[model samples]
Structure formats: C-alpha cells, structure tokens
Target: MNQQPVEGFSKLSKQRKIDWLIKEYLSDDRSYEQILQQYWNGDAILQKLHEEFSENTISNFYMPYGIAPNFLIDGKLLALPMAVEESSVVAAASKAAKFWIDKGGFKTTIINTKKLGHTHFIINVEPHKLQHFFNFKLKKRLFEATEEITKNMRNRGGGILNIRLIDKTADLENYFQLKASFDTVDSMGANFINSCLEQFGKTLTEEVAKDETFTPEEKDSLQIVMNILSNFTPDCIVRAEVSCKIEDLKDDSGISNEEFATKFKRAVTIAEIEPFRATTHNKGIMNGVDAVVIATGNDFRATEACAHAYAAKDGKYTSLTHCTIDGGVFRFWIDLPISVGVVGGLTNLHPLVKFSLALLGKPSAQELMSILAVSGLAQNFAAIRSLVTTGIQKGHMKMHLLNILNQLGATEEEKNHFVTYFKDKTVTHHEVISQFNSLRAQ
Candidate 1:
C-alpha cells in the first residue's frame, strides 16, 4: 500500500481526485474528444503510410509506448514522458537514477553536433587498374573540386570540414560497395554532400576530357561515374555523468543491500562483453531515450542504430554506459551518438507530438540529450531495484491495474475499489466482472 498525501488527495473533490489519477497514471491531459482524435487520426495516417510504403513494412517497427515520470530536463519540469517498452528496462533505469538523485542530481555535458555527409561514387573501370586510379593526384583533385560546395553552408553558419575515402569490399561472398564520409556543420549533411557530389561529378567529366595523356580509347576506359552521400559525419560527441550513494537504495526491504550491490555490479559487467546480453543491457538505456526521441519528433531508428553500433564499435560488444562505485557514491557515465533534431518530420505534423513537445517547454537538442541520459540512468535504477528486491512483476502488475480499470469502464468509486483489490493481490478480470455485475444488480 502507498500513503496518499493528506492535503493532496483529501482536499480534492471526487471528480478532481479521478482527474488527478487519470493525469498521473495515464500521463494524458487530452479530453475524451482529444483522445479520440489521437487514436482515430493516428490510425488513419498509419494506414495510409502503411499502404504507400507496403514494402517498407512500418508495422515491423511496433513497440509499446509508455511514459516516465518525475523527470527534470535541464532545469525544466516535464510530465507525461513517452518511452518504448522493453522488459525490465524502465524499472531498472528509473530506479538506478532515483538512487543517484537521492544523493545529488545527475550532471551531463553535450558537444556541438557536426553533421555527417555520405558521398557515394560509382565508377566502372578495369578491376586490376582500380589501384592506379586511387592516387594522391585524384585525392587532391577531389578535394579542390568540392571546395566551393562549402559556400552555402558557410553562409548559413555551417561549413564543410573534411572528407575520407573508402574502398569496395566483398561482403557475404560477391557484393561490392563504395562509401565516403564528410562533415557538415549545423545543417543535415545529406543535401550538402549530395550537392557537392553533383558538382564534383561534372568536374571529373571535364578533367577526363582535357587529359590528352590518354588516347580516346584509353579515356573511354576511365569512366568518371556516379557520385552521391555517405554516412560519414565530422566530429561531434555528447557526454554525461551521474553519481549516487548506496544509502539512497534503502527501501522497506530488510535484505542485505550490500550483497545485492555486488551481485548487481557483476550482472552489469556481464552486459558489457556478450552481444546477447548487450542487447537487453542497452535496451534499458533506450527506454528513457526513445521517449524523448519520440516526444521531440526526431528519427528514433537512426538514434537506435547509431547507439547500438557505437556500443559494438570497438570490435567488442560492450555497455554503452559505464558504472562504478566510489567511496559512498555510485557513478555512471554514458557517451553515444544521439543525433536528434528539434525541428522537422512527423513531430511537426502530429497534434499529440506538438502537445508533448510543448509540455516539455521546447528543449534544445543538447538539453534534450542530457535529460534523456538522466532518464536512461533513472530507468536503469528502476530495473536493478526490482531485480535486487521483490522482482519486476510486482510493481508492473500494480501499475497495470489502471489498464484493467480502464477496460472495465470502472466509475470513480469502482476505480478506488479496484486499486484496493489490487493491493490485496486478488484482483482479476473475473472478479472485476463479478463486481460490475453485482453493482448492476444494485
């Protein structure tokens, strides 16, 4: 059982009490009509997008959406946070973070973003002569031709910084691919890199024409080919750190908390090396991250891919976050690619997304990442607490009662009774149905 704040609940009228329960538990402030609009309009748009991109199979992207509470992002209060469901994720992170917050708040630092550009060039020539074509002369010419491509970005407070070349390699037997990376500042690098490639392709064609060092036949052999975007971005990084003490984890449980901490550390360490373990390990981190990503309307898939890739970047699967215990304080640090944007995409179109962003007080990209990292740590706390104590099912089942109440169309009185019944561990759909029937008989 949980104690209700006397002034908070007792002073509220019946309707106010119900409204508060709905707001806090459901994390939705929309009226009945507005809620209806979300499901109805959302279903329609999803259907259309699904049909249009039938081959794309957007439905494969389904993940349960839930909200995290008690979060302050960059000093701004936020309620009704959104997150995707993965088992033990929310509980672990939330609890982990709350432990730290009990001592002192988690602190974060973010680096300025340098956008990445992908330039794809497809050239057809003799496979044996490929090595001859990749000379220093060609590298200098490529750089000089693309120099003017930075003009527009420089004008708008962004500029091209650097580029790197990549070679074709065989993957899974006989597939060959070419890619290159470039850095753009401020602007998303796709358009900028594409523009550079378009101009460079022209330059290469003109160079081939002027080079009389080769016969027309030999010139035909040197095909200046397709140039396009690569996934390479310049240097930009974000860093975050959190600290907490074991005293913060003390709960009603009389079990050995110190023993639990030692065990928990070993478990987290296991998550570092094994790919199978790393998936669930990082999933916990993303529980908090995906919510902010969805709320801000940035691309979640890109964020997910980059994060997971970064986790395994050093030729070993490791935790994207680090954990340690120092004296009395437990410390955590996480650094990952959080390439998220504040403006653009479905976030600009969806009504609820707009409302959610407004609820957040319109945070900047850096502030958003900082808070998100905090939430990830918090959620990690929530998970470990459950694993160490009474197990995850208990609290989750308690919270899940609200969903059951909604399903039964329970009235205010019924909702109170429903929650009480849940506390007794006897609540069931059958019991709820019987209670409904009994009330009807009344």
Candidate 2:
C-alpha cells in the first residue's frame, strides 16, 4: 500500500488541514469537509478550546451523552452520566437500577485508596548496602525532595504515603525499583505521581553522588532508567453489591424465582471458567464502566488496562463480577479497582466534564469510584438477567432498531410505522430492510 505523509501537518490551520485531506485522499470531494464541519462547536471560543485539547485537530467527534437514573448506591440515589456510542448500554443500566431499587438498592464500600508508582534504576551494589542506605539515608531524602510537588496534595489530606527500595538483581543483574504507594484522594494523580517520581529519580542521583560511603565507580554505576506511575491500581479498590430474596427475583421471565437465580449463577460460573466467554462478559461490564468514565473525562484506556490486568492477576482470564445464592437470598457484586478524579485534567477544562461532575452531585473521588463500580455491576446484572431469560439480542436488537431504519433511508412516517411493527417482533437488520422495501412496493 502506498502511504501519503504530510509535511508540517501539525502546523497547518484547521481549514488548510481539511483541504489537504480532501485534495490528497478524499478524491477532492468538498462534501467531506462539510460533514466534518457540521460536528464542530458553533461557538468560536469553545471550538478553539476543543482544538487545543489535542494536536492536529481537523474536527470534533461526538458521542451521545446520556443519563441513567435511579441508581441507589450506599443509600444515595444517583443519576449517572454516560458518554457512549454503542446502543442499549444506558437503557440496560437504568432498567437494572430500577429493578434493584425495588429490592433495597445497591450498596458499595471503599476497600482502599492507595495508588502505585515506581522509580526504575540499575546500580552496582551489594543488596545489604543498598537496603541499609535506603532505610537510613536515602528514604528521607526522597520525601523531602518531593515536598514541593506534593505540598498541595498533602494539604488535601492525600500525598505520598510510603516508599521503599526493592532489589531485583536476581531477575536482572543490578536492576532495582523504588516502589511507592500514594493517597491521591480526589484526582487520578498521574501527573502528580509522575512529577514526584521524576523528582525521586533526580534526588536519588544527586544524593548518591554526594554520599562518601560509596566509591566513585559505585556512584557512577547508578543509572536511572525511568520514573512512571502504573495504571494497574490493584490496591485502590471499591466493592458494589446487591442482594435480595429469591422471591423478589420473580418477574415476567415465566421461570420460578429459584430457577432464575440458579441459571444466573450458572451463567456467571461459565464466564469464570471459560476464557472465551469471559472476554465478552467483561466487555458488557465495561460498556457501563467506560461510558461513565468517559463522561467524567477520565481515561477509559487506563481504566480498561487496569481492570483486564486485575481480571488476569490469578494467571487466568476470568470475570470481574461474582454471584452467589445463599439462605434464599441472591447476591451479585464486583470489587473493581480503578482510580479516578473529580478534579484536574479535562475536568477543569471541558464544559461537559464539569457538567457531568455536577450531575453526579460533585462526588469526591471515593464516591465516584463507588459509582463506577456500581455502574459495572448494574450493567452485568442486566446482561446476565437477559441472557438467562429472553436472550441478549431481544433488548440489544430492539435498541438497535433506529440505526437499521436510518440505514434503509426510511422517512419519519415509515420509522414510526416500523417501530410500532417491531415492538412485539424480532428486529434484525435484514428483516427491517426487507419489511421497509415491501412497504415501499405497496
């Protein structure tokens, strides 16, 4: 394939970049530019703000920002803001929330709030000497060096909690790490943690050079590789759970309450033991998680990486959610490990992010964590409930009806007709198109 490269693309103006794209790759079709411009913010200042959010911005891409109401978490009712492109996610969450609310609503607990970062380096030294030095001399220096960067965080009752020197010479000769734990409180703290880690690297090099206990060659042997914060925050966890008597599980499924509970547990067990099933099961869970995460302007990519890693932490891929039936009560829950922020980054700049935070009642980071976990749990319940009864497509395809209708170029009157026709019928792309074409013939 021949690839086209642009010269000084980032330096190009918005209009010029679109022109270049049309002339070079879009067959010089001006309609493409019009389509891109259609999504751009009408306000000049807001459009400029969006452009600077990323580099080489040609135009804006839009996702439907939806709200799922009736979420009762820890005795608090919340209407979650979700930004997603996929169909049926918000509807599923809302339906699940309403179902659980009738029983007693969802409950959540904050297990911990500790995030992690590391300073990776290699130093030629005996293990004992490095350990003794880190304990007696270098450890205090690391804290003192990062005081400036962590001052505001500490004032907020969150900051660097602990640091230690870890030797990994057995795995790789002279490879070591300074593993640190943090309490970032309300912010995702990537920048804050990375800033402190970089300072630690700087302090480690500077202090080692000044110490007379180390020989010149030993000092020179110290090489700092990098300082970074890990997205996989296993220790920072929140648990969301819902429980109800089996009798309450009785619904329109036509199955006995006991039978519904049994099948739901069995479906979860399949996902737990089967890798092929677990992948799709977890994707359904993230349909809820990533939506809320994106709506709040947090990093969905990081959240996904961490959640999947945690799922496979036991050396096999499995489900993030769990379920059990005991003493005639059915319980379902998920202990999700994720770090999010109610402030900073895009929360401070993006208008919708700010609006989302407010819509969520301006929750603290801990509250937000619980909300996200509950979103995932609620979505999973809705999925399993559907799967064990009417099947996944019944609801998903119905929600997807509009997309099919639009693709077939149905008018508003036809749309209303088809929607009513498909209300009690199966909705498939082929069937929808076929029915519309027959209507056109009539």
TM-score of each: 0.67, 0.97
Taking the tens digit of each residue's C-alpha lDDT, what string does model 2 give over 1-442?
3449888998888889999889888888999988998999999999999999999898899999999999988888889999998899999999999998878899989999999999999999998998998999999999999999999999999999999899899999999999999999899999999999999999999989999999999999999999999999999999999999998886678999999999999999999999899999999999999999999999999999999999999999999999999999999999899999988999999999999999988999999999999999999999999999999999999999998888878899999999899999999888998899899999
Tell me the lDDT of candidate 1.
0.59
Model 1, poorest ten-residue lDDT window? 169-178
- Quote the positional error of residue 5 for candidate 2 in Å: 3.0
Clashes of each: 27, 0
Which lDDT value does model 2 have at 322? 92
Kindly report which residue stretches of model 2 are placed more than 4 angstroms away from their true locations once superposed: 1-4
For all candidates in order, the CA lDDT equals 0.59, 0.94
Judge candidate 1 at residue 440 and give its lDDT.
Answer: 62
Against the true structure, candidate 1 reaches a TM-score of: 0.67
